[model samples]
Target: MTASVLDCISLSYQPLWGKARSLTGLALFVQPLAEPPVPGPIDARALLETIGETLPADGPPLFVVPQSKALLLDTLAAVEPPPAPGAPGPRFATRGAATPTVVVPSFLLQDDSLVATGVRLGRDRGLKLVWQGSADAPPADDIRDGFHRYWLDLPPPWAAAALKDATRKAAVGQQIGPGRLPPGHIYGGIESRVLMEYCLDRCKALALAGWPGEDVVYSLRHQAMQPSHAVVMATLKAVESDRSAETVERILSEDPLLVYRFLVYANSPALGLRNPIESVRHGMMMLGIETIRTWLGQQVPYASREPALRPVNAQLVLRARLMDRLLDAGIEEALRREVSLCGLFSGLDLLLNEPLGVLLPRLRLSRRVQDATIMRTGPYGPSLEVALALESSDPSGVQALCAAHEMEPGRVNRALLDVLSEVDPDGPTI
Candidate 1:
């Protein structure tokens, strides 16, 4: 397509993809690269490194695929045994958290086709593949073909025929839910309101039809954010309210993806470190609930919501975490947890271009989490507001907001830097 044509299209196109297409159009206008899809081998290591680089400090969970050829042994060795038939899975080594991985069984098999691998990962992660393979090289068309075939094979009894028809109906503004949803869609914006509503409707529909809600939530998060964050959110939410450690352990035993990410992040300089966290369980034990919650909040990627929005989440999270630390404010750890959650999802609906009310149900978040996310008039809402204001680089506005709490902008700024340093001592200082 011509640059002008692409420009006329929504900016929702992946930035990297848009840039690639723009360059390709220019190149084709001049002289074409000998290859069509610009073929090359997928570099797993390089892709991981780039993901690690692109990751935001206070973003959503990072979904990482191992080097296509990398062994799962590194992550699997530590997995606890699955639970007995009726028992809870192994508790995340932490009190209230899992080790932070989402295991996708089929990803074990890899092939020369990038698309095939991507489909497997997406199915395993329960998300739509966003940045499939790596950015270092382009895939052969074989990859894309294989991916479609695999995806077509992954869905349950809902035949590809049925699912395709349903998707088409949804696209044309047909009755998609138990109730009418506002017109906004993912192709439009990146606010939390838009995303939550879209997901909720889909989840409700699945539940109404007696299907598992996991797949629907996964698709929403993927379409709204990226596969990594989407899967993390879906996986974590899938844990039953009364779930025990045994149940968690069982899930982890088979989920290598979650294990790898947990260990990687646990040891990553991004989490601030004097040494590498050696195991998922060990990391969970050492990180504690508050720290783990913070990490999860950061890992929830909303990058695809809007290009301009990518950094906004990071800034808000940085500010919220900093404020929590500065006042040593005698605030409950749970409140800090709320702050982190609010910061991450505050713009979810906007990013996905859906309504908050429509999507909140899919998350199955506590009334507290839901209240904070929607009303912004609740306990955690004020902090979210402050975090967002500061994200715009408006120190004065932040100061004004904190005035009631007897806090100062300078103090908030310094504390935020300190918190950022503490969270990622060895990674980027900011």
Candidate 2:
């Protein structure tokens, strides 16, 4: 496709967790990059087909269509099944055989006709429906039980807090009635509320049991697993300032591991090194300050001695790479570097079991970087938000963040895919 045409289509996937926090499903999203300067009805079917073609062969099965393209579901429903081999049949009837679940905004449920049509289509094709609701207008009673209702508007952190509050209430309810509480009493009469609360507590307890805690975080950052403090601090200082090669080398030589890793990375196949890196100075001369800084930033996670932190480190690198790639071309090189730092440090709190407010100051990060990473309030904030939103299963949240930043969802999706491909070439589609 031409650049202009390619720019029109953007696709990304969100992971859905099952009861055990296992990845049970994948929700695919195709968002239009343009905001339609001139408002008009979009060609939903054509767009859907285009999106389907762009997806990887082993990409997610569930596809989320924006409410603006509600007609796409209708189009799928109208498709006829193929005839028997011996019978004369329409050539196009065999298409639309895939019965991937179609998730739409809950507001669409307000339309009875659309809901009825969707139900009929779902039943006919063995498809499923998921309604994503906003805080202002959740799913209605009549349709709530029939489909999945994912609450949006609130970010993942806020949603988690709300769930914790609910879990607490449910614990109290459990104390009121030890035995099996009556059904239909949940959130209704006093008895029902108590029973419902108890059930909620039980569910929350079961879920939390499988989750990792501060101990895991602490273990990952154990003294043995920690990187060379002097080398790390020196590298940070070198990257923050326009230090000379002699300064950079002196700092790197303080730690043998730092020197070894830098040499290995500088000569790695990915860098396509023409000659072997003889020393830190040689690598610095061959790769420039910015490249070296980025390389050092990525090394932080890999430096961990704990094998379990490999996945976490990979995720941080992926986020940093994706954020760097998604940055607008107009962004200054320095700001881009800061944005990359923000992405790398975004998860440090979970990694080190320490708040960013404490960690960032220790690193002497610039005020802008500190604000973006800790407070999520700086020029790079939107980029970080976009990165986090890309990891979310909520399409509404992703769309809202993209819109707010005037970012093209397609571009963000493309950047994410590129980063994943580079980071984990053999891994499954994310």
Per TM-score, the best of the predicted structures is: 2
* TM-score versus the correct structure, for each prediction: 0.31, 0.49
Best by lDDT: 2
Off by over 4 Å in 1: 1-224, 229-323, 326-329, 422-430
Clashing pairs in 2: 10-410, 170-197, 185-192
**Every candidate's lDDT:** 0.36, 0.52
Residue 102 displacement in candidate 1 (angstroms): 44
lDDT of prediction 2: 0.52
Candidate 2 lDDT by residue in tens digits, 229-254: 43565676787797876666655643
TM-score of candidate 2 to 2 decimals: 0.49
